[model samples]
Target: MQLDPALPALNQTVLISGPGPFVLLGVPGLVALHAWLSVPVFLLYMAALAGNALLLGRAAADKALRAPMYQLLGLLVATDLVLATSTVPKALAVLWSLSGEISFEACLAQLFVAHVAFIAESSALLAMAVDHYVAILPASALQGTPDRYSVVGIVAVAAVTHGACVMATPVALLQRLPYCGQQALPHTYCEHMGVARLACGDMRPNIWYGLATTLLSPVLT
Candidate 1:
C-alpha cells in the first residue's frame, strides 16, 4: 500500500512522543458526566482545604498545640494539603476546560507530590500510633516521650524513604521507558501505575517498585 505524500512518515518524530501530554479522565465510567460531577468534587476540595488549613493554623497559633501529638497532627495537615492540591486544581481545570492534557514535566511533578503526600500521611498515622502509646503508658517508663526531635526525625525519615523508593527510582525507570502508546490516564490524577502502564517497554520494575514502596511504608512504619 502506498502512503499519502502529505502525511508525515511513520518513523518521523513529531515531538508528541515519549512522556508526552496525558489526559486525566476523572473516575471510572463517569467521564460523560464530568461537568455535573465536578460540582461536588469542587465542593469537597474546598471543604477539605478549609478544614486542614484551620487545623494547621490552630496548631501553629495555640501554645497548647505545641505538644508533639499536635505537631504530628500539623504534619498530617500539611500532607493533606499537598495531596489535595496536587490533583484537585488540575482536575477542576480538566473538568471546566474540557481538556485533560498535561505536560510531561507537570505530570511528573504531580505524580511525585501525590505519592509522597500519600505515603507521608500513612507514616504520620503510624507516628501518631506511637504517640498514643507513649501518652497512655505510665510516664515513669518513658518520661519525655513524643518530643519535638522525635516527631521531626520521623517526618524526615518518611520523606527520605518514600522519596527514594517512590519519587526517585520508579519515576526514573518510567522516564527511561518509551511512552509510544496511549497517553490518556484513566484517573483524575497522574499516578505511578497509570503513567507506567502507558510505556511501550518493560513495566514490571515500575509495577513491582510501586507495590513494594506502597506496601512497605505501612509495614516499616
Candidate 2:
C-alpha cells in the first residue's frame, strides 16, 4: 500500500504486512492542556498507588487482617495496582512528552492486562460482598464457610479463566484484521473498539464480539 501524501509526515508510514505501531493522540485537541492535565493525573496516580500499597502492607503485617475478607481486600488492592500500572505511565508519557508510539504487540498486551485486572477486581469485590452475606447468616444455615485460601484461589482462577482466556478471543480476532491508512488512535490507550476501528477489512465480528462481551461481562461476573 502506498502512503498517502496528504497525511502528516508523522503518519506517512504504511503498514504493509504486520500490525505496525500506532500513534496515540491522547485527549484530542488538548495538546496545549496536556502539561496542565498531567499534574492532577500524576497526583491521582501517586495517591492511588500509595493508598493501595499501604493497605496491602498493613494487611500483610496484621494477623487480625488475615481473614477471608482482608484476603479479598488484598486481592482488590493488587488488582488496582496492576490496573493503574498498565495504563497510567503510558498516559503520563503522552501528556508529558507526546511519546505515544506503541507497537502492535504492546497495544494488545496493554488491553489484555487492563481487562484482566478489571475483571479480577470486579470478581474480588463480588466475592467480598458474598463473604459478608455469608458472615451474617446463621451457623445452622451455612454448610461450611470457605477459608481465605479457598476464596483467594477461586478469585485467581476466575480471573485467569474468564479475564485472561475469554479476553484473548478479541485480541486474536483483532490481530487477523489488516490495519492500513491512518495509524493515529484518538485515545490514551489501545481499547478493543478503538483498535478495531483502524482495521482495513470488515470488522463485524470484532464489533459484535466486543458488544457481546461487554453485555455478558456483568452477567458472568
Most TM-score-accurate candidate: 2
**Top-lDDT candidate index:** 2
Q: What TM-score does structure 1 among the candidates reach?
A: 0.84
Q: Which stretches of candidate 1 lie over 4 Å from their true place?
A: 1-16, 143-150, 153-157, 160-164
Q: In candidate 1, what residue range of length 10 has the lowest lDDT sum?
A: 9-18
User: Tens digit of lDDT per residue, candidate 1, span 24-74?
Assistant: 877779767888889998999999999998998888889988887888888
Instruction: Supply the TM-score for candidate 2.
Output: 0.90
Q: Write the per-residue lDDT of candidate 2 for residues 1-221, one digit (tens) a residue.
A: 67677887646644455675998888988888988999999999999999999999999999999988898888889999999999999999998875899999999999999998998888888888888888898878876766646867787688657788768998999889987655789988889999998888899999899899889989977
Model 1 whole-model lDDT (C-alpha atoms)? 0.78
